[model samples]
Target: MKFKSNILILVLLAVFIVCSVQSVSAANSHNFTTDDNFDTKFADVVNGDTFTFKAGSYNLTSDYLINKKVNLVAENEVIINSGDYRFNFASESNGSSVKGFVFLGDSNNPKATTPIATTGPTEDITINNNTFKYVYDGVSFGRYATNNFEFTNNIIDGFLRDALNLGGGSGHGDVYIVNNIIKNNLSAKDGIAIAYKGSGNLTINNNTISNVIEAISINSFNAPDLNATVIIKNNIFDNVETVIEDPNHSEIIDSYNVFNNSGESSLTHTPKEPANIIINSTISKSSISKDGSVNYTVKITNSGNRTADNITLTITLPNSLKYVKTISKTTGDYKNNEWTITALDAGSSATLSLTLNAKSTGKQTIKSSSSYLNGNETTPKEGQTTTILSVNKLSTKITVVVAKSAILGSTSKFKITVKDKNGKVLANKNIKVKVNSKIYTGKTNSNGIATVNAKISNKGKYNVKISFAGTSDYSASSKSVQHKVTASDLKIAGVKRIGKNYIVKVKNIGDISSKSTKVAISFKTDNKPGVIQYATVKVKALKPGKTVSVLVKFYINKIYSSHKRNVIIEESKTFKEASYENNIISIRK
Candidate 1:
């Protein structure tokens, strides 16, 4: 029994040891650190190896050749500082991938090389999650047949030439470039974000591209013989000169792409439609009085090479204006203030004019749009013109003035004077006094003076407008004045010190009378103790536009001579004034 147990323990220990050895060999098989010659180390790796590099910088002096199907992955931050070409994948290196590594080239001489270049026929090559910066060309592939190539989730920036240049030659494959950010390749002639020339199926989806001369340039080498299919969708393109430059205009399916701040000529393609129609609308007058008529002209021109068939122009009028009649040639119905015209030819314009009467007083807009009746596949082009129709008020000369400046909560008399252009008074006319949308009506006397009384409560500048409706002899007019309702203001007019006696004059320049007002005079010496002298004089009542003098005597001391002294005349708090900022006067000695 002891010998059987010993044999069982030995078999278990041997199995455990074999498993441990295999685990260690698998871990060390495809892991590499930074070495002096990384290109040489990479060449020694076998086929189908998943080699991972540690976080460090590897300076590549010469181009590394990819001869077999392998994966070059970075564990963390790995950068390849290359001089010219970084990797040259041969025809036999099928299904190889390079991911999660940053490739940096010489910025001063960026036009000297590319980051990854494919020489011969390569199939199923994926370059993803890698950043290529300051390279001449980020990736250059073609000249031979390549199939099923994918370049996704990669960032290529600051390239002097094209970021992904797939040149023309014998090639039959589908090239997919998805979810990549390509920017700042500013070459005027050939610095495109993605350029394709050969006959292949190309798809660019969900990529962000900006700051390039051309975002995508597609040109077929042998046009009637070799045709390429391109599918571009869900990409954001900004700050690029041109979004697409398809010279041959191949079969392309493009939709749901966002383009902002790009050039005006975004898509350069041959039009498949019959005509391109442009509509323009103009008003005879931008502003007209109420019940006045305005002429609106809508010009529909077909600017395309082919004649437009069954083209329709629709004009929509605002509720403030009513359509009167059509003055020009029209072929459609005018109902519900909308005019429609049908049919415009190529390089010809159909001018339709309609007179509209101003119904109300405000700004009104006339909207007109035209479209080809063949289909609604394209958006209809629109144009608009705004007109302002005001009420036809007379243009008489009107003057609005307060009869006298009044106090708050007091009845103020406002006089409105209306005159015609010949300086004659318009008598027995109706005038309205509008104070902040509150209307007060009165009739002018024989002297053309309309008087209205209003209780002023708000203490601010009021825009008082006097309007005169037009009569048969005079035009309508309105004039406004900024009338200020203020409290009773008390001010010290003048101050004089004569023979140790201070005389102060107080005045009521405000519109109301003041009662029980006290004027005070005080002097202070600029010493450490600050000796002060004070006196007060009481005035029983002061009327508006009136003045009074108060006299106070103070004995001058030697302390007042040695140091600087200040004398101030101030009104007491018995009355509230309009402005207290100028109430006190200071005399410094």
Candidate 2:
């Protein structure tokens, strides 16, 4: 009976120990869904806890702080739409991992949005198989320190500035970045920007980077160890402006990298007291007329820690502007559109001025690029700023000179002139004049005057229109002048007969001259109204209120002693007359 009882107790103890082990395992792992509150779940979790997020979308409005070691896993198709929020891993959050999750950020505030960041010293943080889009920064190595980080199999498609930023802090152990895709970013200046201060081994292998300005930019660290090394191998770089830009580090190893449409790799020795060049340009007039000129000023500065020697700057003038000459320069000489600076110390600046004539009229652009040397290191960095200039066309005025009143059947003369806004006459300009339903075209002479003539038939008020079609340097203009025209009248004034000679007088009774016409005289005998003899006289142009006399002789067929004769004078129809009653006269002889 005692042996059987001991066997039972041993069996029960074994079962109890097995149950305790299972319970601990269950407590360490937790499952969450999109409907659950992450804050509540995180508060009840302990170190080394595994939180598995179910397949759904999780919205986070604020930053989620992780102060203990944790492992976050995504079940399948997990999306975290964090609007301007990030996951903050604190100092104690070492040995933490974030895996297989998609993070979305508000692209509107990309400069201020970060997907994942570190607050203090963190180590052994693994961020793998994650997708980040529309974020300012993908991952941040803390400013204090970071070590033994693994960032692999991640797709960082879009970011405002940097995809991976090693925040100029001390880093230790090994950093493995493998088999990742970083592409389709226009606002990022550097793909993996590193400014590491500590000693470590960085490996970048089998990664694909494209469409970035600089695939990898390694700036000079503040105080880095001398024995640090960076190994870059077997990476595919395509369509990147620059493959790698590292000017201050010599401990980097690069091999077996395939480049297509990616610019050549640059590696230069570290320079002592490197120089930084800054260029700024401005125009005296943003908008000017085609006949005007503008002044351009370029101020160059050396804002680096040391002085720069033999700095060269080039200015590219657009087709809308022509370089006239150099006005003033504080230092350096300009030729062939290039400006040379012999030396520029740190924190010093120089000014250059030049006059540019507005050649064509439109929006003009001026571009400037520069290159400099520092301590036997010739690294050319291109910097540009577009300064817009607008050249406007000058306005013009048309002046017309004409008479207020003109005589009928006479030519009306018009004088048209064109001038600019500055009262400068524009020569050889085409002009159009419209008068009395006729259009006459002419060009202005050297004196800017054009003469046009039109015939006036009726007597009334009329408008004489003159227009100047502007040239490339001037604008169009038009003017109108009012004119009046009057008609003429002619009449026979008196008639006289002396011996066998007859004298006839014709007068113009209107305000203008009359055309050449004829006058006739007839003689009748006794009481009969039959004409016995006739004579005619010709008269030339008669002026206003003027009279002229002409003589005509006729021979009589038969002479009678007791005969009463009637003599008559009449005017011909060569021009219009006001009345016909005053054009004829009768007398007995």
Clash counts for all predictions: 5, 0
The models' CA-based lDDT, in order, is: 0.74, 0.77
Q: Can you give the TM-score per candidate against the true fold?
A: 0.40, 0.46
* Model 1 residue pairs with clashes: 394-475, 394-476, 394-477, 395-475, 395-476
Winning candidate number (TM-score): 2
Clashing pairs in 2: none
How many clashes (backbone atoms < 3 Å, residues ≥3 apart in a chain or on different chains) does model 1 have? 5
Residue by residue across 397-479, what tens digits does model 1's lDDT show? Answer: 98877853566656778888887655778789998888786888899899989998877666567878878878643467888
Per-residue C-alpha lDDT of model 2 across residues 1-589, encoded as one tens digit per residue: 9999999999999999999977763339889898898789888777899999999999987888999899999999999987778889997899999999998877667666677998887889999999988777878664656678888999988776777875445666777788999877647445443334445687888999887777775544444433457888778888888776555564787655778887767533234445678889999989999868999998988877777888788999997788999999999889999999888888899889999998677788998888777533455555666689988888899888888887776778888888889888888899988877878888889998888787766666787778887776677889888987766666667778788667877788877777777666666545554546556677788888999888866667534333343333334454555445676677555
- Give candidate 1 misplaced runs (Cα > 4 Å): 1-29, 220-225, 264-589
User: Model 1's lDDT to the true fold?
Assistant: 0.74
